[model samples]
Target: MRTVGHLLSRPVAIGTALVLVMLIAGFVGWRLTGGGEYVAPTPSAAPTVRADTVAGRDSLEELVAGVRDGAKPEGKGAAAVATRNADAIGIEGLSARYVAESGNVDEDGSWTADVDMSWRAPGDPTLSEELKVGFDGDGEITGFSADEGTRMPLWLSGPVEVRRTGSTLVVVQASAEQADRYAELAASAVKQVRTVIGWDRPRLVLEVPASGLDSALGAQPSTYSSVAAVTATVDGSSTAGSPLHVWVNQDVIGDLDSPGAQVVITHEAVHAATAAPTNPHRPMWLVEGYADYVALRDTTLPLSKTAGQILAQVREDGPPKHLPGKAEFNTRSEHFGAEYEAAWLACVVLAEAGGQEALVDLYEQTGRGVPLERALRASFGFGVDELTARWRTHLSDSAR
Candidate 1:
């Protein structure tokens, strides 16, 4: 194979090098596998998340109310904040689960939830571990929390492969010792995606690529970029199969050079996993929006730079005529750096304004399932025209 050295630039190379650095981090993952199913007292009985008591009640209740009512909390610790919120709300046994799993903290200093959830409370504390939680912009605990003694066992481990097999998607690749670890990672990723949006896990195809990109693709590459250490594509409205494809650069195996690369792979893996049954027609904004949400949400990238660019662009030319021309966006997308940032924020705003579940709803509507414009209206309770207006206002506020 001929070397494409001419295609590389210093900054781009540096960025790629950063990704290479991230590879050293290896695959950090955890999952909840078979537990024989949670038996019910009765067939129709369902256990509820209880929050019945409060001793420090008055203060904690006020805090949770404030969070639910849109008040940003004083700190960044979601678990701590949630404990406070629950206390304020008078919920009993509302302790944050702290499974003892070290998480990979992102550049902005936030940790991703990559732990075995089965280690959480009320089960086998003898085998449990420490845990963590996640919060939104206003400090509301939007995701699960980890407790200190949640005992869980090893699931699977391996190289951790994810690709398509016929109409089915598959994820398999790890050592014999890590088969369960790899399976757990792929399964958890798929399940995490399906929690909000509905989709089935694709069959796992475990093998290292040794030939061309086509073989790497199990199918064809879409219109997006496909390069060394990365393969991205934007599939149009077609539901023949899954619309996204992802793979690690075999050369950089077991490296974590860039903290950001972990985020990128997980983000693309989400796209690959979220294969809805409808036509794959999502707008550039929604397409990139969902991916961006997965990429940078909960974690941090320099969002302020993107916010500044949005401010400058809006001030100079107003809030983009509708969706703005793709050509215009492509020509200067990086100039804003926040095209991805902005889109992710837009989704976040919509999700918050509606519900955490709104992210999944919007994904479905804008994904290969629902029409883009209709999905926008359904998810945000506003049409594309109105959303552009709101997005512009958000840009203005974020600038300040």
Candidate 2:
């Protein structure tokens, strides 16, 4: 299969968002630690001896010089270099193209070099990797990595079209015409998220791949087949500093102007904006709910349209006994839409009771490993039970 080239080194959390009565599943929020073990690449064959090298000089420097001259080392040396390079770059399953940009050996017999390189996986030729590399005195590779701000695979390389919208960089992986169209929608979504959340200088990287939504998301859930988009962390580490990737599933979001598409973009943008490695102990409902809340905030869409699923459930079964829990947000759950609606309304209650600032403070606090109930009490002067009661009432009134 010809999949689009993009990098995804993180596990994803799946949720859904309802917009104008349209259920778009696959909205993810916050990075979560300890997911999907990384599979390391098999060791390469040993390096070959180069009879052309002069005696008494560092082999590593010779290797570096060879790379500068557009040569790749072979055998054991090649294997070592490849392994080190992969570790430094934080990716595996790659074949590297190394170029020594600049370097010098120190008096201590140690050498350092600034090398530029690209990594390409056999499975995806379109996406190649690029980063600067640093080598130690012993010729061991050191500090090889790409910037955490925006990491793109080779397919997303030049000719892919990059547009800067505020602090966000929108990379469109499609024809120039289609890319331009996606860029406009993404820019609008970024602006709306910044304005509503009071995030003045938020930085984001949004990608609209021509294909390979599953590759970008690492794994595609069957339930997310209709999802418009999703946001995922680069490395699954809260502190990795890798960029948050907003992946738009073109199949579902082909029409950027549709109400559902706009809402999906904004909702996923909120996840990107507020992204942090989440405290597993914290309630996922709040994390996801807050994203939905920000996405739906201030929209003129009727409550009946936005919260129709929850309202319908309420009409049949009455208000939920409690706010949506983590399990309720499961993609396979029959109540996926209802769960998201309940979570969104829960945040709505929080916003109404204490204002948007309080909701944000609560979100940030909980994200920083603070207990959810404690964060709630601190920000809203109420406990979870009390807030749950209020949210239930809010649901009843909103449904009516």
* Candidate 2, 230-316: lDDT as tens digits: 676654345434456677777768855666666787788887777633345458788778878877886788888789999988888
Name the top lDDT candidate.
2
TM-score of each: 0.41, 0.59
> Candidate 2: worst 10 consecutive residues by lDDT?
1-10
Task: Assess each prediction's global lDDT (C-alpha) against the native.
Answer: 0.44, 0.61
Model 2 misplaced stretches (Cα beyond 4 Å) = 1-161, 198-200, 220-223, 236-240, 255-257, 277-281
What lDDT, from 0 to 1, does candidate 1 have? 0.44
How do the residues 1-400 of candidate 1 rate in per-residue lDDT, one tens digit apiece? 1223432444557666666556644322112333453466756764443221222233334544543454535654433444433333223322223233234433433333333322111111212223334433232333443332231111111122333323333333444343343334444445445554455544322222322233333334331123222323222223355334344443343344443444445454556655422334666556556655665555555655335666666667665555433443352244534465567667767766777677677776565557767776776677777777777777666655
In candidate 2, the residue pairs with backbone N, CA or C atoms under 3 Å apart (3 or more residues apart, or in different chains) clash, namely 46-75, 46-76, 47-74, 47-75, 47-76, 110-137, 111-137, 126-155, 127-154, 128-154
Error of 2 at 22 (Å): 86
